[model samples]
Target: MRIRATVAAVSAALALSAFAVPAAHAAGSTLDVTFSSMKVNSGKAITVGATSTVKVKATYTLTHPSGVSVANVLSGPVLYRGTSAKDADTQVVSDAPGTCTTVSSTTLHCSATITLPASDLYNADAGTWKQGGVAVDAKSGVQKWQNDLGTIPVRRAAKLTADATPEPVKKGGTITVTGKLTRANWETGKYAGYATQPVKLQFRKKGSSTFTTVKTIKSSSTGALKTTVTASADGDFRYSFAGTSTTSAVSSAADFVDVQ
Candidate 1:
């Protein structure tokens, strides 16, 4: 009787183990992840060097069985871009795991403060950048979910500076205005001049807020600006750059000049 009981116990345990393995692997229903929204610069272009951290938001919904819980959610810059060393997958932008707040049984509010290093931004091309998110299930290792947060243009940051010679000048005198145009150069690790680009010379009366564009001047080979203008009234002078496909527009601080 003892030998018979031991054999029966072993057989029952083996049967339970066989049934459990199949049930765990054959989880039913497809897992779905829907991101209702994402915000990056109000759905506009992203200007690198404008900020160190990229703040993004997304609302997500996971649809699976009632007992399944989300394992991980991630958001970062990615490419459905061309095959190139620089364009290869999202190696430049590191994985940013989102810390989500639960809203309901199947819904989650997620966000990630992603950091795009200056070096990466400096090397990456200025074009359409995609924000993607992914979700995983904890219980059933078989579930997979992915959604596109959105896409936005990423551009380089440019700089402009202006100065007027002989700040105190007699009325009706010819004053020379000098300035420089520069932007980030990843290869050189320096702020290099951006030449042959059109920039506007603008002026505003000391008491007035409105600025009138006096003339358009192009930068020289060294990105230097040297233009002479007749000083009439006490006013402020500056330069404005209309950015290119790879760079963002920028304007210099107003340089105040005193006219006697």
Candidate 2:
């Protein structure tokens, strides 16, 4: 899988530049700004799928000294996978600077978006990520970075499939259900099996809107699912995965079965 050129360039700049800003800045000038109330994706997990781009919204409060001119500053949110941006295993940044609304002479409420394309990420990138903010003085090139404002989960999107064999079966006969569980593999830009995860078998009567859990089973090493249920009535069957820290929950399309 190919990592986005933009991300690679930005990541390299983050490691080499001062305060994690893309641009080079003066050595000793202090931006003298503080970031607070940083909320990434509204404090929710970021779920990304294969071949799609995920845009995450972030909001924060920026405070600056009255002597500082906020008009010439460019600031935005940052997501990193290590202790700090300079040493991060991977990092993601907004394409544009954050837009801010002045709340007071010394405070501004800012919002920005960070885009994540599956091709730019690796499977190992899924997990807890630290949140941070960066401010750069457009005039003097002074920069400041605030790390560990909070943390958020970055998870891979999961998929489940369910199929019931024997469209029409005797009421007392056996019905076999099978499925596969898979999640986005950013390393390969494809969906791969998610093994050893618990998934639920659910059923709903033909006319019902709610599905009740029938049984629970663990996916095989290959993420394949197979089970047998005694046929009793006409209904729909599906597999449901509750999800985990690194994966998003998903349910398969309902497969209708007819009982004689």
Candidate 3:
């Protein structure tokens, strides 16, 4: 495991923006902090209107000037509304603080959870968001020893719904499968069909544990799913969307077919 001690290379694999490092007016910097074991929802996908979201957790070690024990740490996902700091909006993404716990003289940990309603993220421009930590002096509150936790990609939510028709069919007969692919539209506050996208048809025998790809199909102009397969055995069929850079992936529920 590579231990990251890059004091200069502020950006880690998770990709945080240039440190806004709140200015510290103290003498020779108030404190020095190092953060590690940073975990952000296991780097999971975040969606709008999602509740009870525990976005980030991290451990820290601190060094203070002339024996001033550290105070609190403020950390969480910080969002810059646009592509740059000049954007009109900037702030932490959660309502909760990056609550911290001290385990030793130089070791501590922190975490934050948020339930952002649609207004918090759905309307924001698509771009990179950051997670980070900051140290404050116990006596004075000058922020310092800040470290960037990482980043979590923000993408539009997508959904896949499917159905296989002619449920009980002759063993050698044809069964039609249909489905649709849709994605969140922030402006309209609705989910709309995504057209001309590649989706895969997958199947698993009712008793088998594996699902094999049957074929790749494309959605129609209206994001409609229409495909036919020759029935051979009782099994479950589903559709999966591989997803694009601007959207999240999704898979439809299994639709079982009874072969007579």
Candidate 4:
């Protein structure tokens, strides 16, 4: 991480104009940030079911709204937004401060990434970095050069896992399976950078001999899938996630439905 301060790089004409006109102070120009690669590694992609150890790189280029360029530094806590779940938060980066290293007098570059978990998927957005001391509104003036982030969609190691809500649902009503197809970030393109396997939901009526396919669905970007089933006979139902080898067992021992 390079943190060196560069001289203000706005053009002489712009600087003169900024100095000549007091309103220029209030009319803060927009620093638009664009990315090159939002990947875990610079050029490589992590295969499904494998752990990713690459640091994500984002090549960012900043431009002013007025076209009169000025150089500025950006840093601080960067939050990567994922599906709405609380634990779904993937911290792409924690905290590291890097200043702008200008390519020319007018251009600059910088990068940062937070450690990612092995089972967790990765995806993030390029937004204005919030500097602690700077007011929220004023922070927009600073732009961190962005790289198109590379994602390491990690596949879960082959194993047996079960996901269900309420453990076993009430009989005569419904049972729900909160399923997820989790893998390491695999594939390519937009959604490929993250791991969210399409979920499979199978069920059989209570005491039924064979389990039947009730529904198949994919987890949200955050890896969440759910299914609800009603029991025909009071007993036990057997079902499992399709594709990968996984299963869940629930006993609907209660014979009657609870109308409430």
Best by lDDT: 2
lDDT (0-100) at residue 12 of candidate 1? Answer: 29
Best by TM-score: 2
For candidate 1, write residues 53-158 as lDDT tens digits. Answer: 3433333333334554555423222222333312234322223445577777776665544344355444456667665433333345333323355666766678
Candidate 4 wrongly placed segments (more than 4 Å)? 1-33, 37-39, 46-59, 63-72, 75-91, 98-100, 118-152, 155-260
Each model's lDDT comes to 0.59, 0.83, 0.60, 0.34
Which ranges of candidate 2 are over 4 A from the true structure?
A: 1-24
Backbone clash count, each prediction separately: 0, 0, 0, 27
Locate the minimum summed-lDDT window of 10 residues in model 3: 1-10
- The weakest ten consecutive residues by lDDT in model 2 span 13-22
Q: Return model 4's CA RMSD, one decimal.
A: 16.3
Model 1 Cα displacement at 249 (Å)?
Answer: 1.7
Q: How many backbone clashes does candidate 4 have?
A: 27
TM-score of 2: 0.89
The segments of candidate 3 whose C-alpha lies over 4 angstroms from its true place after superposition are 1-34, 49-66, 72-91, 122-128, 135-141, 145-148
Candidate 3 per-residue lDDT over residues 1-260, each given as its tens digit: 01112222222212232223333544465446655555555676555422222233333333334443555444433333333321224334333345677666766566655333334344444345555544434344444433355666556778899899897999999989999998877656677888999999999998998889999999999889999999999999999998876677889999999999
The candidate with the higher lDDT, 1 or 3, is: 3
Clashes of 1: 0
Model 1: lDDT to the true structure = 0.59
**Residue 227 C-alpha lDDT in model 4:** 64
Every model's Cα RMSD, please? Answer: 13.5, 3.4, 8.0, 16.3
